[model samples]
Target: MDFVEQERMAHGIPSQGKITITVDEYSSNPTQAFTHYNINQSRFQPPHVHMVDPIPYDTPKPAGHTRFVCVSDTHSRTDGIQMPYGDILLHTGDFTELGLPTEVKKFNDWLGTLPYEYKIVIAGNHELTFDKDFIAELVKQDYYRFPSVSKLKPEDFDNVQSLLTNCIYVQDSEVTVKGFQIYGTPWCTIESIPSRCITALYDNCSAQDRKKLRRVVNTAQRITQTNLPSIDSVYTSRCLRQAANIIEDPSHPGHSLFSPLPSGRKSLCLKARTTTLKDSFYPAVIRLLNGPCIH
Candidate 1:
């Protein structure tokens, strides 16, 4: 409702020492659902993409075609949502309410039910618990802003990343699934989130981890998720442009940065080494698209 509330919820700050799941918003009409980003679908010319009905569950896909389902910013409110079938499930970020262990377990339980062969996930800005360094820094460093945040104990959130047992949790790392080099990271540019107070990933990463961080753009056969803060439409395109300018590269075709709202496709590109798509980070229904990959 208010900017303070939005900021608070975005950071998973508890209202009264307890975090609650926010309702996920979905775009009723399909087109506007893609808020604004730099990824152009025309470049790859996907074989086909069926968004509205999702071709029904367990439907057949063409041979050599791999369907990828991308979703983000669910915020731990996936109770009634209907899921589509795909070979790989790429959840960009924000799957939990507060990145709490209980919330992570709930999200993990849902992941367990999914029939997808591979499920890859990365944390979003909302994953306050998973970004334990951010929490420690907040409690120790920031002076004026984190009055409530300073109250959070680092021990409660330590090893929070471990709760994600059901899916491949990748932060500044890569996992090769079915020959596709899928890398996931929560690294946000200072330009992307200018208001950011804590340097989460940059401060936490080791010297070696920083090396992998630099390689993010160059190493993606398919880099699945990026959580960019939602700006109004007038600024969305510009913000996305700023992000793409840094992430996109003409030399390496495999590097693409995709995130929900902030994020799919069929036949996507049989040989499309690098592809980018933007889905509205808020809505879940319209956010569901087939990420077409091959086996």
Candidate 2:
């Protein structure tokens, strides 16, 4: 493929209005099959790209007509509590525990049965196994297991595919729905490998395993890298020593900003509040849009 064709392929774009190519009937090439099918049997519709009218910087806030319900980190606890009804149901992350086949089936079953018109879901750290590549492979193979060469179970892959069929799974991407630009990320602080049974869960750093994990880490870092530095890094650098000294002068109110901990620690004050680990936004949206409560 030339540069233009390679660029198109990189973005999964169709070249020109139409393109034609011939291939042998016995060809087992997946790309060839897709291209061939697209050339004849498939009809491609150009995306609808609408331009929104620009609003003045000082324009007044629009009337609060639309309600948005956000939920996150459900981790496969659907039936434990009733969901609040809303125009949109947003489940932010950790849709299932371990991202297992059975868990996904139950999660999808519950999500599909919801009364909300729009249901959006995102994956979280616990769903480490449910990456886009894994999901795509599962879908392509009709949720079957890899042959003896790979140990990934059939049930696991199939379940992921099944769940994806009904719900929108956002990876390192964004979707526009009802004037909102929704971006999703499934990342969290890395946990120490607690168990060795599932190699995916922990770092079993053999030469091959190191290569695999390094690739995964590098890809993830590039995908989520941002131009801005964190507040701590910007403030504590040696290059900012003069500025830091000025800011931390005795007369400065910021002098105590980085002071050592007090001799006696204070006890944490506990409040009686409903704590939600996942889908925290879903219920809030339901309460706002579908009235204070869905149940």
Candidate 3:
């Protein structure tokens, strides 16, 4: 028996090397959950076929079926949450409330205790320590601003990543397991900008500020493009907050409602926040993927 694995984006562009598996016959009943197959490999083949010592095959067989249990936005509270049994555990991000190293470590410890065979995690806006550039920009604007609680420095990046050792961390990347392709990103739209400056920015800001603003906008556009590919599903930290009026009446507001941030001067910090949420806003991200967008 031969098993070939080919990874491709939704549009048919191959993204990874093809994995060919040759195995003996094995049977398992399929369940209502994701599909799973059992392969009893009688021989181990190297990247190139060669006569080598037979390798031990201790790999555990699937637990009857492939099941996925997903949760998101835990915000560092995991004790009371009851997790269901599944072959794969998916956490969509916001594992930490403040992105603090301590918080991250705590979440990681909790994740390590889960019974799932495969675990996947992604960062959320609250996980600021993961994105050094964004945090540095925020610090420059104002150390006292929102999401600056831990005073995280660029040096903490590796430390944070190291703490989450038990699960696969994904950021604007894709992973394949059991022939299923899963893509995850922590990006989300920042709080909405006030309607007042939506049109005034080009007229009043200084050249430097304008340049900064443009860069922010451009970065957001690029991030949005990352989601344009077709995929089985998307896992993201940011989720669309249903329009309030739409939910209330279904006719009062014809379009989605994005609440604006409290009125304030447009500062670099504000720009950074705006940039994160601007192009890749929840609605826009969902529209581009054309699939179920999990938060």
Name model 1 segments beyond 4 Å from true: 1-59, 140-151, 195-295
Q: Write the per-residue lDDT of candidate 1 for residues 134-167, one digit (tens) a residue.
A: 6786678654754555566766778888878889
Summarize candidate 3's per-residue lDDT along 1-295 as a digit string, tens digits: 1122221232255446565555323212111011112121344332334353432333343433465677889998999777776678889988987687788899999998988888999887678778777666775666655545535566765457778898998888999876668899886541122111333233334568656755554565475442221111111211222333233564555333433324422111112245434334334433333343333
Residue 130, candidate 1: C-alpha displacement in angstroms: 2.2
TM-score on alpha carbons, each prediction: 0.47, 0.40, 0.48
Q: Say which prediction, candidate 1 or candidate 2, comes out ahead on lDDT.
A: 1
lDDT of 3: 0.55
TM-score of 1: 0.47
Q: Runs in model 3 with CA error above 4 Å?
A: 1-64, 145-150, 189-214, 222-295
Candidate 2 Cα deviation (angstroms), residue 188: 4.4
lDDT of 1: 0.58
Candidate 1 RMSD computed on C-alpha atoms after optimal superposition onto the true structure: 22.2
Q: Residue 53 of model 1: what lDDT? A: 34
With candidate 2 superimposed using the best TM-score fit, by how many Å does residue 69's alpha carbon deviate from the native?
A: 2.0
